[model samples]
Structure formats: structure tokens, C-alpha cells
Target: MRNILLLICFALMSSFIQGQEILGDWYGSLQIQGTKLPLVFHIKKQDSSYSTTMDSPKQMAIGLPVAITTVENSQLLLEAPAMGIKYTGEYDHTQEIIAGTFQQGGLKLALNLSRDNFTTAINRPQEPKEPFPYHAEEVRFYNESDDISLAGTLTTPEGLEKFPVVILISGSGPQNRNEEIMGHKPFLLISDFLTRHGIAVLRYDDRGVGKSEGEYATATSKDLSRDTEAAITYLKSRKDLKISKLGLIGHSEGGIIAPMIASKSKDVDFIVLLAGAVLRGKDLLLLQKKLIEEKSGIHDSIVNRSQEVFHGAYELIASNTKTNDALKEDLAAYFKEETNNSINAAQTNSLIESMTSPWMQYFINYDPTTALKEVDIPILALFGKKDVQVPAIENALALEKLENKNIEIFQMENLNHLFQESETGMPNEYSEIEQTMSPKVLNLMLEWILERD
Candidate 1:
């Protein structure tokens, strides 16, 4: 899911030297699935009044006027003096496409927008009908980085210091500090709950995610490790945070990153894993693809073929054998042939990008099981019994194989991928209802971190 705050905030920064009257109904899209949903951008110029209206098919929003930093015929640099996100929009007058990238730091990432009629509807996920147990805050911080200012939110108790601060690292994807999706921000809610319980939380927009500077898709896991390292270092320097008893928590792909951080940093006092994978990423992806196919009702024949292709791709990334240019050309040709007929270019790009990206490449080559042994901290690994995204059975077995004596395992019964309760165990269970991290699981984690302090 594209973090909307980042997209809309940066859309205003374009370096296009627009024509005398470059105002019109503009539209664009952030390729999610295979479809180009409407991202309607309307630029108007009337007398001395210069303004723009932005809309999208996905949600209801009113566009705010942008401060035109610079406008040249084909290229435009626009800035939203209000939000501070700047974009350099390249206009193709003939095709009526304003696309290229939205830049913040040194990274220029892809962004595509156009012009069309926009529809609006609010899809906010249902809030908990049951009383919520936590109070929270979302305060942005300015992280000092080389190319851009990294931004993050610090969630803590209503008013207190010397709390056991935990840095929440995101799993794979360009995730904001909230780890938002389809109207629900899981990490934000998670932070809210944890903080109300007396734990301090530090969660940030993954570099290039929300307000953070960098390219999300191109970032490798190692790069994320550095980002997390920066976060940990930042916490240690703070007078309010009790850095001596710090903890690191990761989920999904984050599960892998937690160990990577703990292996290098002596500052981290404990670690927690929720639905963490303890196997090779290549192997994990295959299982995930198969499970997704099964849940989505994909045909077995097609699933088999996809598995073969993915297996071959994974092997290529991991192989030590040298290859000639001809082989490379052949592989490239095969990839093109396979995707040439996709109906949605963005979905096709998503598949190709997911497979070909640096992080994915690095991820597919390494095994997390190896890292678990080296992670010599007080470790707690938990998995939902019904999780399909990362099978609880596989992860539990891997944890069992861990040589460390300090490891703890909690097998949550009837829980779905997100640790929400679901007995059906069907793949559709995750989306059918709203669920949050169980209070039991949350309490266990807090106790683990606080006890050590």
C-alpha cells in the first residue's frame, strides 16, 4: 500500500516551467494491483487567482494550493509550502501524462499522475467497538541524515520518562511509521496500545516511506538495518529514554531485521518476534506465494508454473556459478515474454519490481534460521496458529531448533496472520473482520521488556 500522506504531500513539488495557462484537469495513479485508479489533479489559473484541486477515486479529499517553486514547459517543480513535500513533475503534453518521480532526499522514486474525473468515498476501517485500552500520541522527529531529514513518531505514556523504549522496525514494503494499509494503520494503533501500557515506542516512516527520505522499493534489508541502527542510536542519546534496557521488535520481514540489529548492537537488551520467519527468505516466499494462491483460489496448474519460475529466479540469485552475457539475455527475454501480456502495467511492474528489486534479491538469498543462532539476547518469538502469510508451524519448528537457551515461544491459538483471533483458519479471515494484537500477547511483550529493566 502506498502511504497517502507521502504521496499527496510531495505531489506539489514540481519543477515544470508550465505554459501561460497550464491549468487543466490532471489525474494520476500509484500502481497497486493491476489497475490505475484515478488520482485526479486539477490545476486552475483564473485572473490573478492561481490554485489546484486534487482528488482521487480511492478517497475523499480537497486539494490545497501549491507554491510553484519553478515551472518550465515540460518540467515543473512545485512545493506545498504547507506540507513541505516537494515534487518535480514532468509533463508529456502529447500523452497528457504527468509522471516521473517525487523526490525528497537524494532518491528520485517513481510517481505517475494524470487527469480525469475523480470519485470519492471514505473507507476507514471500523474502530474497535470494544473499549480501547490505550491512549497515544504521534509526534514527528527530525532525524539527521546525509541527503534528507528522516521523520518519525515517538509514542510514550501520557507523561513520563525513563520508560523502556522499544523501536518498532517494519517488515518488507515502503511502510510509514503507522504501517498503514486500506485505511488501517497497524503500527500506529500498536504503538498507541503499547504506550498506554507504560512502554515507550519509537516508530518511524521507513526511509523513503512517509516523510523519511530515500527510495522505498530499491532499499535493501541491510539499508533498513542501518536505518534501525540510527533509530537505536538516537534513542540511546536521549535523556528521557532508559537506553540501558532497550528492546527491538519486528514483524513479518521485520522479524528478520530484529535479529540483524541485535547481532550487531549491544545496546538492545531484548527482542520480540511476532509471526517472525526463522527460515530462508527464498523458501519463505515460495510458501507465501503458494498460500496466497490457495487463498485467492488460484488454479493448481498455474500455481505450479509460478512456483517453478520463482524457484528458478531464487536459484539464479543464490547461485555462485558465473554466467555469460548470453544467459543473461536469455533470462531477460524469458522475463519479458512472461509479462508482455499483463493487462495492467503497474501490476506487471509490481511483480517484476518485487522480484528484481535489490532488497528482494538480497532477501531471497539469505536464510534467517542462520541469524537466529547468532542472536544472543533474551528472545521471545510468537506466531499465530492460523497465520498463512508466515506459517506458524514452520516458524515454531525453526524456533525449536534454535540453540539459544534464552528463547521463549508462545503459540497463539486460533490467531490469524496479524495475531488477531480467527478459528476458521481460512485465508479470508484476515479481511472479514477488524482485529488487533491480543491483549495477552501485548502484555507478555511488555513484561519481558520491563522486567529486564
Candidate 2:
């Protein structure tokens, strides 16, 4: 799939002058096509130089302030090491607004700033136990794509007879080859286990992610599908490959992409869905809101407000609405209501903007349900009962809608979004828990691969 970033750039310019009290929270929405994306800049000015943070309400953990190094003319740049870099917002003195420019691979817009008070939480993904059961080597391959050759690792058994090969696909959100999310790298563990169990596995970094080429923020998951199809085509061309059968396995968003490739391609013989979605992404996000409320340990009133904010932002994105002054106001009001007595206003506004960015808008508009039901290959779908990221309970129903009965479903009772154990469904439980992949998932996948025709 081609990108739509360049075709959808409106005005996102702002004006700022010297000797001004830039110390305050600046808020505004970035526009991508018809949708309005929200964003916040918590500007902390200390004399001539200053530090600021650009954050997303959707991603609380990545909300750390970034140091600003150089400022020349109207352009201002901010760099946050742990996450990614952001270049946007012009200093505006005429309007007293720190206007939005380009962020998260979207258009530019101006933000109004005022001396506002707020608090924030800084989070780094915790390390967790390996997901797969066995040990395997990590290898990289590069080729295709005009930007950079895609790179991926190969995991094979110790003895290495040409064994059945399985190529892993990650869900969404700029994942590494291991599909690293937070602390757990499920693909790494899965490849380790499957290869050691007499299977060959290949998992790669998404293009523009991890040692791969291309700009990630400007790409789509459909692009990843094309990448996966390339990986499969590459494997088929190799003489090193063994066995008569080939397989494709995916987790979360990867699960959705797996089916897309299998449907059109002639090579993929078996498929595995690890917490894949069956519903439209927009609906799935609503379910995600509910999950977030439960996980955040919040009240019902707060939950309702959050839903409104999420849906409103979603409507703007799906319809590709032009972000105007009114859109920004609607967002700020929603965040104010949601964060009242809960999170700091600045932080809340940050989250709101981050979720509505151009790329995020597109992600929510894409659905995997239609594709999941169309793949004709043998499918093994697994869901942890505790999984909140891609609620298995809701996805389980999609199996009944498959075009054929070739799909097999397996649901594990205690697993959460990361396949980590959680009795009460709390996210912190993942850090407290061990073994991100259930032993049962390994057994089921391995057995299915061996038994499939």
C-alpha cells in the first residue's frame, strides 16, 4: 500500500518571538486529510534554551520530555532519545500560539499555549522472560524495497535438516522483528522454540523499524503485508529451505496481516493467529477503551468521557475531516473532562493529540475481519482469556463467520495481551509475571504444523 502523507499537508505554521514566556502548556490538533490529530507541547523555558515534550494520550509510556537543541528561524526541533524524534511547531509571537507543524508523519498546525499546570508519568518497557521454549540463532537478510532492503532473522533447529518453515508477522505500531512490545518480544521466543522443535522460522524488523529501511511513520500495515509476501517469495527461492509445507504465524496485528497474504499467495500452507482481530479496527478500539478503563482502575464516569473522546477522534480520522479550530476545542474539552481529578491537563491533552495523528487515524480505519475470514489455508487461532489489547472474547466470534471450516480456534484462560499471566487483568501484572508465551501455545502451534496437510 502506498502512503498518503505528502498528498495531505495543509497549514501548520506558528509564530514565536524572543523574550517571551514560552513557559506553559501548548495544545493543538494536527490535520491529516479531513481528520484532526491532537498534540501538546509542555514547554519548560529556562533562560535562552528550553526543553519540551511532545506526547500522545494513546501512548502514556512514551511521554517523556525531549531536549531542544537548535532553533533557527521559524523551525523548532525536539529530540526525545528513548522514543523517536519530532520536528514541528513554530514560535509565534503575533498569535501567542506555539503552532503545530509536522508530527507522527502528518501535517502541520499551530497550537495555543498558556501557563498551565500538569504532571506526568515516565515509563520504560520492562524486560520479561522469553516467550518460546527453545534456543535459536538470529540472522538478518536484506533485499527489495527502494528505500532499504528489508532485514529479518532466521531461526532453525540445531541439526538443521530442511524442516517446515514458518515466517512470523507482527501486529501493528512500528514493531521490531521480534515484534517487541513493551518488555516482551514474542516473535523472538516463538522463533526460538519453533526452530528448536525442528522448524525453520524467519522474523524481520518492519521496514523503517529496527535495522530496516524506509520511513515507518509514513507507511501502512498493508505495506507490511507486501513485505511479508516478499519474505515468503524469497524463502521459496532459496535452496536452504526444507520440507514440503510452508507456514505463516502472526500475533495481534500480525495475525490480521497473515491471512491477507495467505489468501492471495499460493505458498502459505498453514497459518496461526495469536490474539488476531476479527472485528473492524474502529470497533476494536472501542473495546480497547473499555479494556483501558478496566486496566487503569478508573471510575465509570471517567470511562464514558474517554469513550467519547476516542470515538470523536475516530470519526474525524475515518471521515478524514479537516482539522479546524473547532476540532481542537472539541478535543481539549474531552480531555479536560476525562482527566479531571485524574491525570494532569497537559498530559491529558498530550495523549489526545498523539492518538489522532495522521498515521494513527489511518490505523484505526483499517480492519482485519474481512480478510481473516477469507484465507483458505488451515488456520490455528489462539487467544488468552485475559488479553485486553485485542480482546479474544470479541474476536472468537469471527471464527464462526469464516468462509470455510478450515479454521481452528484455541483459547487460553489466563493469558493477557502479551500472553503473560494475569488473574485480575491488571497490566502491571505483566511485569510481575514470567514467561510471556504460554507453554500451551507452543504445543498447539507445533502440533498443528506437524499435522497440517
Candidate 3:
């Protein structure tokens, strides 16, 4: 799961200036820990009054109401009290930019908004240009369990009479077949590389995303496994493709689901888990929060306090004893007391709603060990040494203790959750890195799969 606190705290920016064109969309990117998060400000003038809203495109949040907007002496100030965000800027007519600073809590970053919504184009050199080598097909399959149609791409080598096939399971969020994020299409590249190497690859949009049908916001990980099962069924039905072996290559939460299916299905021959969690979901999220905060240079005391707050909240959610309404009241009272009533009811409600969501509740309590142990098929689990979200040390050690003869684990050094060669292994550097995935990791996966084949 993505860090809810990080997203909420950083859903931030905006600006305007006196005597200049400011009644349009102004765009800029906030540089946080070497990560570029783009924000847009929609400004309009209404009968001698000015109003504005903010958008954080990177977070998929738009039209966030700005409580206050004002301009005086050619300087513009905007504030969103609910989110504790403030932006101050001055329009440089010659430069055609609103040069400013964005502040939220103790964090502040330089932001420059322009009429032209242009940021430096992120280079994705690894993305495939053309597809002459492999046969690529846009396909649709039915998730009969959910009564949803899922769309995806299937690629296979040209000359193979029968080919080994694997379904690519994306990590969290509503991803398309490409599993596109931060301008990186890891799944598409994986599909391309493996198909070119004679493995048939099937990757699809999440249930409610892209061309697929169904709702997404309410679905949990177990719900998503049904989609993967559907993909497996679809591949099995395509007997003309002559599949030699079937496997699953899952990243992050996908790693969790792969075992869930492989444990029950007789058809799965192998499974590859990338940064799968060995710790229970609750423990994993706690570790993730601490590591990310420390890496981002947050003070120790603050991190500890935040950890304490979330730990209690997760415990409450995990208890599963209260009705939804009762849980909300309890959570509201708990948060208010924990924060010394500094947080407003709206903020508390937002926190309560997110923590109590179907996905969150399921993830906090779900343990993959049972499924991992039951899966007798060959398993390859890889972790990035620098991955803070699913840090390798504890999880890798946990898997090692499992000592399942069928399970093999490896850790790649200096890599992040996305498997990109990273300096700090923070999510901020994902887009800045040009390589989609480390060649070493990719080669290892290929070699491992082919050897098993």
C-alpha cells in the first residue's frame, strides 16, 4: 500500500500575481527529496474577487479548494487551511513565471508556475519503440467471479510452436497493462523483454481501470486475485498458443497475490515475487513508515510520534470488533486524544475513512505465510536492498526462516522498490533514473525462468 500519510501531507501548490495574467492554469513541480511532484493552480476572477483551486497531478488529486487567495504589490499568496499548505509568489513578467515557495508544516520547496505547463521531459530510454520482433495482441478476458471484463496485451515469440507463459501482476493502485507510474512502464518493458526472449507474456489492466469494467476503490487484494485467476483461465483456454509452462511475475502487492493463487491452483508451475512482504501487512506498513521518514530526513521524535499514532489506529482496525459507525467514533476519539485535539474533525474523518477502507482493513491483517507455505511450486523471491517500502533485511530473513526448499530468495544491492538502481532508494528518485529496471535483475529473472523451463 502507498503511504497514506505521505500522500496526505504532500498533496500540495498554487500562485497568482498582481497586474499580470494569472486567471488560467498555472503549473509547476515541487522538488521534494529529489522527486518532482507536479502541481497545478486553477485561478479565476469572479466579479472583483479571485478564487483558486489546486491540483496535485502526481497524486491524482484535483480541484482542491484553496481557502484563501490574495494579491498585493505584485505578490500573490494562496493558502489551503485544511491541508496546512501555503504558496507565495511574484509574477516576473519578463520571465513569464510565478516564482514562489511552497510550505506545508516544516517542509518548504521552491516552486515556479508558468502559463505553459512544461516540465523537463522524463527520459524513459528503456521503453520499447516498435514491436516487429514479437506478436503483440490487444486482448480482453472475463473475470467471471467479479463479472468484469478486463483488457490487456498479450505478446508471444513468432517461431515458437509452444511457449512458456506468465501473467504480470502489477503492484498496488489502478494500473493499466503497462503498470505505468512516474513515466516508467515496468510491466510493458518486462512483457517486451520476455516475449522477445521466447516467453509468452500476458498483462492486463486492473479490474476497474483502463478498458476493464467494474469498480476499483472498494476492491481489496483478494478481490484482485480473481482478476489474475481470470487471466490464467484465459491463457489456459488459448490452447492454440501451445503453452509449455505457466507462471506468475508479481511485484509488491502482486507478490502477495501470486502465492494466494499458486497455493490453490494445480496449473501454476512457478512464481516470481519482487519485493513481496514477509512481514504481516501491519508490521510491514509500520516499518515502511519509519524507514521512509528517516530516509526523508524527518526528525526521530516526529517519526516516533507518527508511528505511535498509526500503530494504535492499525490495532483498532485490526481488532474487527466494532461496526463501521462505531469504529469511526472510536477512531475519531482516538485520533483526537492522540494528537491532543490539534487535528480537526474533517481531518480525523479522512484518516478514519482511509484507514477503515476495505483494502486497508484486509491488508493490515492478511498474512502471506500460510499461502507461501502451501505453495509447493518453485518460487523465486527477489528484494532490492535499498527498497524502503518493502525493505529487504527483515523480509528476506523471514523468508529464509521459512526454509521452504521450493523457495529461493535474492537481494539486489542499491536498488529501490521499483528495482531501479537508486542512490537513496527513495520513491523520489524513480522518475529521475533513466533505467526502467536493472539489467542484472532482468537477466537473473530470464536465466532463472529458462533454467526451470
Tens-place lDDT per residue, model 3, 1-453, is 454356444333333334536677888888876767887778777665666767665553445556666778768787766556678889887887889998865678899999875434778889988835989999999999889999999999999888799999988877888988767889988988899899999999888778999987789999999999999999999868898899999999999999999999998999999998889999898999899889878899999999999999889889968788898889888998999998766556656766787888899999989799899999999999999888999999989888899999899999989999999987767767889999888898998999888
Task: Tell me the tens digit of each residue's lDDT in model 1 across 219-323.
Answer: 777777778888877776677555446888998778888988798778888888888888787888787777766665679998898888767766766662544
Clashes of each: 28, 26, 0
The worst-scoring run of ten residues by lDDT in candidate 2 lies at 1-10
Model 2 compared with the native: what TM-score? 0.67
Measured over all alpha carbons after superposition, the RMSD of each candidate to the real structure, in angstroms, is 9.6, 11.1, 4.9
Is candidate 1 or 3 superior in lDDT? 3
Q: Which stretches of candidate 1 lie over 4 Å from their true place?
A: 1-148, 158-161, 320-328, 333-351, 423-432
The 0-to-1 C-alpha lDDT of every candidate, in the order given, reads 0.65, 0.64, 0.84
Candidate 1 CA-lDDT value: 0.65
**Per-residue C-alpha lDDT of model 2 across residues 1-453, encoded as one tens digit per residue:** 011111121222223334445656665555544444345566556655555655432231223345444456755654332222345556666676555434433223444443332222323233234554444455545446543577888766655555788999876666678775434567877777777678888899887777777776656667667788878877888886565689988887788789888878888888988888877777787877677675666688867876776677667657755574456566667556645635445444445455565556656787776676568878888888887777777888766666567888877888876676678654445534546577777888888897873
